[model samples]
Target: MTTAPVQKSSYDRYPTVPLPAGESVITGAAAWHRVRDLAYERAEDRPPLIVVDTYPGVDLPELTRQLAEAWPTAVIIDVEQEAAKPIEEIDARIADNLTDDRVFGVMSHLRLNAFYDQERLAALAERLADRTAATVLIGWGAALTATRPDALVLVDLARWEIQQRQRAGAPNWRSANGAEDNLRKYKRGFFVEWRVADRHKRDLFAKIDFLLDGNAIGHSSGVVRGPGMITGDAFRGALAAAVNAPLRVVPFFDPGVWGGHWMQDKLGLDTETPNYAWCFDCVPEENSLLLSDGDHAVEIPALDLVLTQPRGLLGAKTYARFGAEFPIRFDFLDTVGGGNLSLQVHPLTDYITDTFGMHYTQDESYYLLDADEDAVVYLGLKSGIDPDAMIADLRAAQQADHPFDTEKYVNAFPARKHDHFSIPAGTVHCSGANSMVLEISATPFIFTFKLWDWGRVGLDGVPRPVHVDHGAANIQWDRDTEWVTEHLLQGPEELSRDGDVIEERTGLHELEFIEVRRHWFENHADHDTDGTVNVLNLVEGDEVEVISPTGAFAPLRIHYAETFIIPAAVGPYRIRRTENSQSTRFATVKAYVRGTTRTDQEGPALAAGNKGVRS
Candidate 1:
């Protein structure tokens, strides 16, 4: 099939979401009155519940007082005060309650979900109802047992904002040692604890009446209608409008031992932290969507969109393949000016499910973005390398506290910008220093088994733990240097050329559920999701605009290194090139689920060239 030219229509302009500044929406005492007015039309029998759920250490006493003044007959009830046990007692209980080997990540302190007793809160809500006056329950999980509040306001702070607040030495209920322990656990892995805590809060989305922007809390804040208050019919209509429009998720960053300055310096991220290691560009599990209604912005977990509109976001085929789960994930791994990452491998599909209570495995690939002239990526094993010998060496190094020559066993390939390396489950891989890699993979993250860490200690001055036995069991012994070069080591191949645009395909291994392609164009390119969700990354060029064919969406402008997703509901959409002084040719990486039927676009699909599976 030949390519077509870019179509011009009335909606051929850049898409913009008008989000008013936080100060304009909510600032001081005047702003408090405006926030109180959100529940003005409601009856007195069911009082407005403005649950100011702030991050730890963020005291909302002043806001609470203002809320009381706005409703003279309303009584403020702090959930923290209603706790059945003291903070110290809860801490001890949590320490003694551990019986499993579950991991802890960023939300470490909440692993036990030990803050308050749910039964107590439910009973408290009942007793408070006996009073003749209106009741305003304010605190985290306050609305969990609330009796149909007129309003439920959620004050959420970004991850970075929480980090900054903690670094500023704000007073938290936890002790200094407890805080330090949580931080250490976060660096180890944030998914285990975070997911558990978040699963309970999923229903909170349906309960939220208003969302308060806490990005600049104490200075400025913004409040908008929440997704929970919208009816199903209304949400469906809004979802349709959003699908045709370009959507961007609120990306989050975390630091690691092998973090680099590439994202910190190039992306102009927060340098106050150690360094930027991983950027969750489009991972719905940990990312949130910033939706604006022309006046205010509300933040909702990206999973909410997937859960509510799976077919609309993920195409029918993709939704069937992975129901209510965003299968693809785009993230950045920056090791520039830092040390090499740990030599690791993920478990196979069946292994992961049997071991960890997860249904899917984390099959991933590395797309080199920025690299030093001599940068190398360690992958697979050297020819004639013995698996038993390597396992013994790893164990010996761990016991002796000594570093071994890892280069002697593993093969290293020259890493250049735009190089694609397929790393299916059981393949040993690690991005070396001085390279920034974009990791496109399955959404089941945080299951890496680190075999070696170069004998280095973590930022906490303690040696990071390694799982040599786990890695040894999962490593594919047959994947040697020759296998790596013949299968994983390859570049994007030109598939079809049409005018100034050319479609180049890469990472087409059978082991991977998703396929990647790069579109090189000077002006614009046409693409169809084809019953699947398409994730786009502007790897090259300054900025580009994504426009819908039927003028259903507002034109969205995406800059270099930024990632965005086009829902399957969009169907056929055009990616129009925008003017940029930096470069002329715009190169974007498009990823989507591999169709059941395959065909030759311009040539044959690039094959992994591997024969054995689970051998």
Candidate 2:
């Protein structure tokens, strides 16, 4: 319950893109002045109409109070109170998606417009038809109240910040559940609120006159403060620059029941917290991006880049396959000097699609960054295990006096530094204590069905959710010790070598869509995105520089344990050791979507197998 103490760290947690020399962000009172000036410029004969559309979790009362102070004479309408449906009605509509389960829910297909009453919307529009004085409309769906506003301002918030607010007792949009559990709150946001808001947000990116940083407010002791505003041109330019070069999202660390001290020591995180369990470095859905002009920066959701530049950031092949979604995810899991992770299995593809509305399932791999001598990874199942008996034992473990004998049913493999273990869907797996892992996998990350938690509770003093019935239906009984040893225990195979640079193919299992490659170099290494986005991490060195061959982008310096992205449009680039790096040899692990076919010059096929469906 204590706040995490701030500490100086070498990790570049707040990565930013410098704006052009002549352009700078406007903040505080100046931001409101600029908005007023833009509104006057957009005015024709009558007074202008300004619409401030907001994402959920924005400080509406504070923003409105400020707007009232700035424009005392303007008529301000609260869009939700005027046009949105009642809280009870809205809850009923989304009840199916926001299921009773605390941690899981079906993905919603509803749009923002569905939350509003059409008759009320018409009435609100009628009132603003002949306004003499300036008028202002604001709320989550404010833009829906007017057809063509003279001035449109978008207020955006990152999902991670939203989670922080929820944990601090903020309710979901238009709901009165501030006292609810954090898991249920997160489930509602993940399944229903965020989906509808994103659908509405994507349609406004092309037309907004200005973008406001909702995350910048109320930062009493941070490097940046709120009310930051940027011209639409600057906003679009920043996103364009990110797609053409290497970039990183702001990383966030959280404490867990099985958390460890590795991140605290390595990443320079807060030592006051009990432990750091996870670091979300590349999950765009819950990360923020900073756009700066050297002197000042504005923080916005990283999802904005994906929504605005889907084709450029994700590449044509990836965008077409996933439809504006970033399919790959990279995160850190620390269990060193702590407890083991929960025994879990991901639902098969067919099961996920049928039950959760997800097109793809989570197929993941753990790349050990560092490990203690006693580190181990539980994978697959012990050979010749009885399926029915295993399920019964797992069910019985839920009782107060029983503990599931994990070693009796699962195969434990020795874990070491740089070891890669492939985990296809339906395979049971968990990392044991004393291991620092860099997990790379598909982005459907919340689908894990925990079968056991080593008889432990969460940091909140609550028992974690267990999905034994779900796991029972999806476990691949055939994936026993022998099958796992043959297919899942991956050893690096040398793919090519040139002088000091060596490339090796690491396994993610042929059944999985992601392809991983490790590169080691003393001088420099060449890489091509090959029409797909590449996510890489400096797994072995202190620092390295990423540069484009054609001078397409400015050089980007990456530090140890940092994850950076190279968009597909980058074409050809090179990574070389920085002058400050102490290590003679450097290493990086890169991941991308696997192509359906291979060329003769690319080498023998490393991944070739059909993903099976659940029976």
TM for every model, in the order presented, reads 0.80, 0.96
- lDDT string for model 2 (1-615, tens) is 576666655689888877655779997778877887788887867788999999998988888888888778888889998999998999999999988888889999999989999999988998888788889999999999886998899998888888888888889998889989889999999999999999998889888888888886542113455568888788888898789999998888899999898999888887888899999999998888888988778888888899999889988988989988899999999999889999999999999999989999999989999999999989999998899999999999999799999999999999999998889999999999999999999999999999999888887688999999999999999999888887877467777899999987785788898888889999899998877899999999889999999999999999999999999888889999888888898999998888722321375665432221110
lDDT of 1: 0.66
lDDT, model 2? 0.87
| Count of backbone collisions in candidate 1 | 4
Best by lDDT: 2
Report lDDT (CA) for all predictions.
0.66, 0.87
Clashing pairs in 2: 216-226
* Candidate with best TM-score: 2
lDDT of 1 by residue, 60-155 (tens): 564466566656666778876784356577556555223233332222334324566777876787776664555677765565556466666665
